[model samples]
Target chain A: MVNILANPARFLRLAGAVLPWCWAAAAVTGGVGLWLAVFVSPADYQQGDSVRIMYIHVPAAWMALAAYTLVAVFSAVALVWKHPLAHIVAGAAVPLGAGFTAICLVTGMLWGKTSWGTWWVWDARLTSVLVLFFLYLGLIALRGAFDDAERGNRAAALLALVGFVNIPIIKFSVDWWATLHQPASVLRIGGPAIHPSMLWPLLTMAVAFMAYFAALLILSVRAEIAGRKLQALLVAAGRNEPAADGLQGEAR
Target chain B: MTAAVTEFFRMGGYGAYVWPAFAFAALVLGGMAWRVLARLRASEGALDRMRDRAEGGRP
Candidate 1:
């Protein structure tokens, strides 16, 4: 199934058909999620209205990890199977992942300030997430560092695969070390510990964020493919020559 | 609605932190979407320019 969907043209057609639905779903889910999170969900007994941030923070954090996993998986497929579309999909995911990671960091800090009386802490979970953010930056930077597009893709793919080691570290940081960050509530061996009222909106927002990521990622990949086509057109027109055959050319 | 709005903005006395967090998230998301659309438009413009050039050269 993955191999069959590797064709760029086929993927593009499928994405076009699905993109509208993804966007609509994201919008609908986000609207409902926000409503439920803000109005319907009961305030935390301890945190009060500030608990609302969880509606955004938790989903962003989830997507941060999810997006990185996607990048690593796509990278692996692109390398092992030599799927061209995989590279584009992985490359398109970097900015979105970085954005999600940033959201997690910023929101975590904000929540921390209220809960822990500090805006920042070097706790195990926080530190590992910070490392994950840097790994994303490194991948983004390495993608453009080579002179050959293929070389850049390969190098970025390798970095993504290597950097995946941090994902597990981020996931288990709270368990591995006593930290201010809470242990898993929604995902656990015994099942979610969160109350149903909070759990529903959280899950809804998570779905909304995932759909939003899908929509944005498809748009980014389409833009990238279009940009590449434009470059080819320019080359054919003799209006411009291909840039230096380095990794940097492929980075964008 | 007014009471809810007031309460939300109050953020139970943590308004400073809460509102800014929400605003920042919105800004980042909005900025990303805008940037992507802008790049798409720029690429489309370049394609148009190339097509125009090709047509003029042909005539």
Candidate 2:
């Protein structure tokens, strides 16, 4: 299945067909999620209305981890299978993951300021997540450092694999340490610690954010493929080669 | 609705921190999306220029 989908044209066609549905789902689900999060869920008794930040912060944190995991998985596939599209997918995921991670950090700080009486802390959870953010930046920078695209891809893939160790550390940091950040509430082994009303909206928002990431990732990958094709065409034109031949060579 | 709006704006006394955080998130998300679309458009334009040159100078 991976080899079959390795063809760029086939991937492009499939991505194009699915892209609209992904965007539509993101828009609809995000709308509903926001409605539920903002209006329906009751404010926390102690934290009051400031508790609303959980809706956005939790989802962003989840996506940050989820997106990095995706990049690492795809990077491994790209390295092992030598799939060209896998590198592009991994490249596209980095910025989005970084953005989500940034959001998580910022919102967490804000929540902390109000609830924990500090803007920041050097707790295990916060520190590990900061490392995760740096790992993302490192991958993005490494991708652009090498002139040879294949070498850059491989190096970045290796970095991603090495960074995979941090994801678990970030997840378990709250559990493993006396931290300001709360431990897993919704993802507990037995059942969620949250109320049904609050839990539903949080889950909805999480799904919506995941869909949003999917839509944005597809867009970024399509743009990357188009940019690669354009670069090849320009190179072919500069060499006085036929554009038709250039495109045909690519399609193969 | 009015009471909810007032409470949200006031953010239950943590308005300063809460509102700015939300605004910052919006800005970051919006800025990233804008940058992606802008880059895509620029690449498309470059492709069009390349295509035109290839076609026009075809012998």
Candidate 3:
């Protein structure tokens, strides 16, 4: 399947077919998840309604990490195997991952304000996630830093692989240090410590977030592919049109 | 019914933080979705126009 999808045309065709379903899944699941999170689930006995933030915060955080991991894995593939789609995918995923990280951080701060009685803390988990956010920004900046697009992609890919060291740090930070941020409840060794009342909605929101990310990733990848084709066409046109228009030729 | 709705929005006095948390999530995700879709539309439009120009100029 990976070998077959290495062909851009085949990949585009598969993406086109899968895109509609991803959008549908995102819409339906997102709506249902929101409903469950707001109305169906019971409030935390201690945290009260503030706990509702977890529905969005935790899921966005998960997607933020998941998306970065995606970029890193594909960057490695692009670097090692020299797959064409891999670089485009890694590049396309950066903005979405960054957006997710922003959502996570902001919502986390909001939750923190209500729970921890402060807006900011330099705890292990929080600091590491902040670093992850910066890594996302660095990848975006690195990708556009070069005149040659391929060179930029390679530079960004290398940075992505290097930045992946932060992922595990973010994951283990809560455990390894004394922090205001709580350790893993849902994704833990024994099992989820969260009650079924809360767990179901959390899981539902996770699905919604994943479906949303998948839909957006596919859309972004399509845009990147189209942009590349447009660039190629423009280059070809530039080569052809020089004798006809000297003014434009000078600009080129 | 109105009171109940108000209470739901109020969110047991944590409304300020909770509502904004959800709202920002919606804003960020929705805003990104719009941008991505617009980009796809713009690129596809450009590709079509270029293809048309190529055909017209060549033929």
**Among all candidates shown, the one with the greatest lDDT:** 3
lDDT of 2 by residue, A76-99 (tens): 999889989999999999999999
Name model 3 segments beyond 4 Å from true.
A241-252, B56-59
What TM-score, computed on C-alpha atoms, does each candidate reach? 0.91, 0.93, 0.94
Which residue pairs in candidate 3 collide? none
Candidate 3 residue lDDT tens string, B9-45: 9999999999999899989999989999999999999
Model 2, which residues run further than 4 Å from truth? A244-252, B1-4, B52-59
If both were scored by lDDT, which would come out higher, candidate 1 or candidate 3? 3
Better of 2 and 3 by DockQ: 3
Candidate 2 residue pairs that clash: none
Q: What tens digits encode model 3's per-residue C-alpha lDDT throughout A134-205?
A: 999999999999999889999999999999999999999988989999999998999999999999989989
Off by over 4 Å in 1: A239-252, B1-4, B52-59
Could you tell me how far off, in angstroms, the CA of residue A203 lies in candidate 3 after the best superposition?
A: 0.8
**Which candidate ranks first by DockQ, i.e. highest?**
3
